[model samples]
Target: MDKIFESIEEWMRNLLTGMVSSNLTNMFTDVNEKTGDIASQVGQTPQGWSGSIFSLIQNLSDSVIVPIAGMIITFVLCYELISMLTEKNNMHDIDTWMFFKYFFKMWVAVWFVSNAFTITMAIFDVGQNVVNRAAGVINQQTAINIDSVVTSMETAMESMEVGELIILALETLLASLCLKVISVFITVILYGRMIEIYLYSSIGAIPFATMSNREWGQIGSNYLRGLFALAFQGFFIMVCVGIYSVLVANIQVSDNVHTALLSVMAYTVILCFSLMKTANFSKSIFNAH
Candidate 1:
C-alpha cells in the first residue's frame, strides 16, 4: 500500500512537471527545431525516415494525450445516457448497477475507437474535404487582384454596370453562405460530444449518492430521461447556431464588430439554454418518483 501511494505521488509529480515544461515557449521552440532537423536528415534516406517519422508521431501523440483523454470522458457520459434509457424502471431501482454497466460499455467503446485507426483517419478525411472545398472556391473566385476590384468599385458611379456589381455580390454571398453552413455542422458535432460528456460526468454521482443500489439506479434512470428530453433542446441549439451564423455573415459590419456581436450573442444564448436544461435535468433526476 505504501509503495502504491509512493508510485502514485511520483507519477503525479512527473505529469505536472511535463505539463509545465510543455507550456514553456522555449521548450516548444526547442522541440520544433529539433524535430525539423531530424526530419530533414531523415528525408535523405527511406530507412532512417521511417524511424524518425514514427518518433515524431509518438511525440505529437504525447502532447495531445490529455485532450484525447478528455474526449474519452465525454464518450463515457454518452454511454451512461444510453444505459439509463434502456434499463427497466422499478420501485427499487438499482442506479449504481446501471452506472457500472454504462461505464463498462463506455470504456469498451473508448478502447475500440482508440485502437481503430480508420475512425481517426475518417475524421481527418472529413476535415480535409472541408478545407479543399473552401480553398477551391477561394481560388476560383478571388483569382484577380483585390486592389483592382476595389478600384473598379470606386469608378462604379461612372462606368460600373448593374449586372457586373450584382454578379460580384452574389458570388461573395454564395461563398460566405457555404462556409457558414460548414462551420455550423462542425460546431454541432463537436459541442454535441462536449455536452454529452459534461452531462454524464455531472450525473455520475447517483451511484455513490445513495446507500442502496436500487435508489442509485432510479436516479440514473431519471438523469437519462432528462437527457432524452434535452435532445430537442440540442436540436434547437443547432438551429440557433445556423441563424446566428447567417446573421453575422450577411451583416455589413466591420470584421471585429461582426465577430464581437456574434460571440456575445452565441455565448449568451447557448449558455442560458444550457443552464436552463441543466437545472431542469437536475430537478427531474433528483425529484422524479
Candidate 2:
C-alpha cells in the first residue's frame, strides 16, 4: 500500500504538470490561428458553406437590390431635375450653373453606388494590414512554465492515493474540454462575423444610392460603421489573448501541494472565464455594440 500511494502521488504530479503546459499551449495556439483567419478573411470571400451563403446574398443583391437602386436613382434624379427646373420657373430664370451643379451631384451619387463594394473592402484591407502587423508583434511565443508547481509538490506527491489520482484525471479531462470549447466558440464568432460583413456589404449599393438623404443614408453609414467595428474587434481579441498569456506565465504557485493545486484550479477557472468574456470585451472596446 505504501508503494502504491507513492506511485499515485508521482503520477498526479506529472498529470498536473502536463495539464498546465497543455492549457497554455492550446490557448495561445488558438489565438494565433484565429488572428490569421480574421486577417485573411478581410476583402476575400470564403469557401464551402460560407461561400455558398455569400454567393446567394451577392446574387440577390446584384439581381434585385442593385437594379432597384438604379431605378430609384433614376426616379430621384428626374424628380430633382424637374424640381430644380420648376423651382426656377422651368429654366426661364434658371442659373445655368445650377444645371451643372445638379448634373455633378447625379454623377457623384451614381459613382458612389457603383463602387460601394470596392470602397468598403478598402476599409477592411487597411484594417487587416494593421492587425497582421500588430499581432505579429504580440504573442505567447513560448509555452508557459509552472516549474514551481512541480517543485513544490514534488515531495508531497509521494503519499498520494489512488482516489486522488482518479480525481486528478477527471480534472485534466474537464480542463482540456473547457479549453477546446472556448477555442471553438471564439472561432465560430470570428468567422460568422466575417460572413455577416460580406452579406451586409452585398446590398451596400442600395442604401448608398440614396446617400444624399439623411434617413436613407443611415443604412449605408451604419453598415460602414458596423464594418469598422467588427474589423477592430479582432485587434481587441488579440490584446485579450496576449494579456491573458502574460498573466498566466507570471502565476506564482506556492510550495504546498494543496496550495499549488488550488492555485492551478483557480487559474484554470479564471483563464476559461476570461477567454469567454473576450468577445464581449472586444466588442465593447471597439464600440461594436
State the lDDT of candidate 2 residue by residue for 168-263, as single tens digits.
545545555665676566567566767766776677777678765444556666666666766665566556555555654555533443443444
Clashing residue pairs in candidate 2 are: none
**TM-score of candidate 2 on Cα atoms, chains taken together:** 0.69
The local lDDT score (0 to 100) that residue 82 gets in candidate 1 is: 51
Error of 2 at 76 (Å): 3.3
- Model 1 deviation from native, Cα RMSD in Å: 24.1
lDDT of residue 125 for candidate 1: 38
lDDT of each: 0.39, 0.60
